[model samples]
Target: MSEGLEESHQLFGRVAEEYDAARPRYPEALYVALEEQSGMRLAGARVVDVGAGTGISTRGLLDRGARVAAVDRSDRMLSRLRARTACGALLADGNDLPFRDGAADLVTYAQSWHWLDPALSVAEAVRVTGPEGAVAAWWNTVDAGKADWLAAYQVRLAESCSGYVGPALPGWSMPPIAGVMAAAGLAVRETWIGWTRSVRLDDFLTDLRSRSYVARLNGHEVEELVNRERAEIGRVFADGRLTVPMRVYLATGRKSRPGGG
Candidate 1:
């Protein structure tokens, strides 16, 4: 891994608890869409959830009846995952999985794919899953266009946060996921799911702080940023409540079965 990426991973390890408590869960519809696009049911499927930080996605997969192995490089993150879910939590890296060939019926990355090297991780995902098995990845991004306050928030983040790269807001650039999956000999499909959440301003700020970029800042810097954000948001929401819009970008790729279409 690159030095910067390694630093980011270490930062996430330090804030695992904050991340688990504040991050928003994926919409139920995203899982439904995953099954539809992948042509595979989660019920009873053997799944390897790569980059399974804090088991947020693992719990969801488990709820859908998937037998999931939650894998991450950070023991701190995996510790949180193990504490909350009964799934097998493994200390592993996505770029180099420790599973045997065809060991999984499906492999998934939720909100964590961006941290990995797709060229290596995509191939590893394909190698571990059986023929016709699927690999799915998704990210929940803020729909800044849906609200004026959110748009201003993005602008503020862009100006003040050194680690921020604008991923939380709409129109941010993403890696070429479809291209990488196709190169790995899998058929790829993509979809977007839009949703909204009503959260207390304090809780929303907590969620914002959990963002990898924001979490990496020093304590005083983070506090200053949060205070400024609170004030700006308060101006828009005097009641200290916010209706945050979200968009889930999902991509599912299925390996072709031998002697089948």
Candidate 2:
């Protein structure tokens, strides 16, 4: 990985606890769409969740009856994951998994794929997944530009954090998923699931702090950004709470055979 990306990957460890608490969970509809798009049921599946973070995606897969092996590069993040579930945990990078050939029924990256080198990670995903097995990558992207307050907050984030490249505001456009999956010789189906969460002002502020880009800032910068954002949020949500909508985009594909099936 490049130095910037490596640094970015390690940044989440600083706030793993806050991230686990504030990050949004994938909705049931997303799981349903994954099943439909990948032709793989979560029940009785052996899933390897790459870059599982603090087990947000791992716990969700486990709850749906899939035996999940959670893998991430951050030990602190994995520690938080282990605290929540007894599922197998490995400190590994998405580009280099420890699993053997065809050992996994499904491989998933939830809100973690952006941190990886897509081509290498997808290749590793194919190497570990069984023939015709499903590889699913999804992200919970905030619809930040939908509201004026949120849009202004994004501006503040960009100004405060130099590395604040986003999930594409306004429409929340997804990354180039089809191209990367195709490079891995997989046929992909894309699906989108929309959901909303109502959070108090404090929790919402914490969510901002948990962002990888925001977490990379110095402590003083984070404090100043949060204070400014809090004032803007107060103006937007008079009752000190508001509903934040998110769109979960799932790109699920099947691993191709060696001879090009």
Best by lDDT: 1
> Model 1: what TM-score?
0.94
TM-score to true structure, per model: 0.94, 0.92
lDDT of 1 at 231: 93
Per-residue accuracy of model 1 over 1-261 as CA lDDT, tens digit each: 353644646878888888888888899999999999888899999999999999899999999999999999888888989887998888978989999999999999998777888699999999999987999999888888788788889889987876676655456665568888988889889999999988899888888888877877789999999999999999999999888998999998998743477
Q: Which ten residues in a row have the lowest lDDT in candidate 1?
A: 1-10
The list of candidate 2 runs beyond 4 A from truth reads 1-6, 167-172, 256-261
What are the runs in model 1 whose C-alpha is more than 4 Å off? 1-6, 167-171, 257-259
Q: In model 2, where is the ten-residue run with the lowest total lDDT? A: 1-10
TM-score of the candidate numbered 2?
0.92
